[model samples]
Target: MGGSNTSHSNLKNAVLAFLVPLPSILFYLTFLYHYQDDDPNLLSPVWKWCYNHPILLANIFFFFNVNVLFWLIGLIQSSHWMIDPYWTVIPVLLVHYYANHPLAVENKYNVWRSRIVTCLTWVWSIRLSHNYFRRENWQWGVREDWRFTDMKHQYGKCWWWVSFFAVYLSQQVFLMGICMPMYVIHLENKQLDILDFVGIAICLSGIAIAYFADTQLHDFVSRNKKLKELGKPVVPNLDKGLWQYSRHPNYFGEQLWWWGLVILAWNLGYGWTFVGSLINSLCLAYVTVLVEKRMLKQDYRAEAYQLYQKTTSVWIPWFRSPLIGKSKNT
Candidate 1:
């Protein structure tokens, strides 16, 4: 009876999580559909301004519908969990928006590129969303990310205002910045070439790596949980498969995917789009440090993890370093 009730409650939460963003999505779709006709006279002053500035429109929508609205919802729920799922989702939305915008030139080549990129974006989104749900045991909005929780404790009363900037607004910048490639791809119409194929290969490889790494990590955690339940000692660290070569194969993969998109945009003569991927990579580097620090803080795992770190590459997969013996003279 308890198990059945838990399943039912999980399903309910999943449904609610899925529906929470529907209104905002619907509004965006409706706006895009109307904007497609491109009749300046038919649009309101606000709409006209938005039509003229598609990027600005996206930012405005994100600010109001996402930043402000989600912040309020987070306050009410006392958890900022909703944004984690949307991290996977928002890129899909942005790609489609760019593809459909008046600014996008719809030549045969452009349409083909857009379709290919959009499909890949969807694939990435699905993989990430599935991982998130699985990691959360299909529950949603019940807990905040550990980083956010830590910040909350650190900030105390200042968290309310600090979160607006640190959590929501910061995300606004990063998401928009990282998605510049999608916008550039739509804005410029170029013939498909070798670089496009290269980008596709890199993007797909990233997705595959991330999928496998996350799966392995999830399995490790599950196994550890079971061991704990049975009163057995849990493995201190995972040092198998892809993890053997890199401490964060998943982060490396994610970076490859974004950099791949930047390649596509660069091929289209918008090399500036590389800035987004670069910034994202830098942020990920910082996150990797934080994650390692947290891992070392775990007493049981610290010594083993430290040895693993010494031998393992941080991001890129490479040959593990040999352990050096200390010299008596030294």
Candidate 2:
């Protein structure tokens, strides 16, 4: 009975997450369409100026759109999960906007670059958004991320404002930084070459690896939960397959995916801005540390996490110790 009620509540939360911002998003899109179309009566001088600068218009729209949704959901549910899907969704939107620009269709090389980047980004975004939806059970506002919960605990009442500036805004800044490649890629007409092919391969492989790792982890975790609920002996942790090789093969794959984009940029001679990928890698490293720290604090799995950390690579897939020999002996 208790489990049923909990499940029902979770379903409700997920539904609310889907429904809450949907109206606002629809309204915003309608407004944006009219604004971009330059509806004669509704067009203010400022908006007309904005339409002339599509990038600026897009940046502002997304910034406010995300912020408004975050604030609404955060205030209602006190959770940060509503922001999860935007990380994948935003980049695709950005790239799509640039890809469809009139100039993008003018040159053969530009069209290829635009198509490749957009298609790859769309593929990645769909996969990520699917993963997030499944992982969160679509309960965006209800399933607050543990990191945000910890911050709330630390900040007490002030987390409301702090989260806006510290979490949401900072993430937007980082997202824009990493998206520099997509932004600048449309500026050049460099034909696709061997490096671009290599980049595409690497990007696709990274996505596959990450997707596989997530699926494995999901299966293991779900099985563990079911065993626990059935009052049976549960698996200690997910330490088989890819998890055996790295504490975070998914994160490793994620880093590789960005570096793959960097390779695309480098092939076009868009140098230095490839630093975006480096920044993304550094951010992923920080997130890995945070996740490991959280896992270490779990009373049931602390020692196991420590052992895993010592034996497996943190963000790279490899064995750090002779666990193979120990396993064979056992």
TM-scores, each model vs. reference: 0.92, 0.84
Q: Which portions of model 1 miss their true places by more than 4 Å?
A: 1-16, 36-38, 324-330
Model 2: residues with Cα > 4 Å off, grouped in runs: 1-48, 102-105, 138-140, 327-330
* Number of the top-ranking candidate, with TM-score as the measure: 1
lDDT of 2 at 307: 70
Clashes of each: 0, 1
Candidate 2, residues 124-214: lDDT per residue as tens digits?
A: 8988888887786654444666777888899988888888876688777777777777867777877778988998899998898889888
Q: How well is each residue in 129-181 modelled by candidate 1, as lDDT tens digits?
A: 99998998877655788999999999999998888888899899889999999
| Cα shift from native, residue 63, model 2 (Å) | 2.3
The Cα local distance difference test for each model comes to 0.87, 0.74
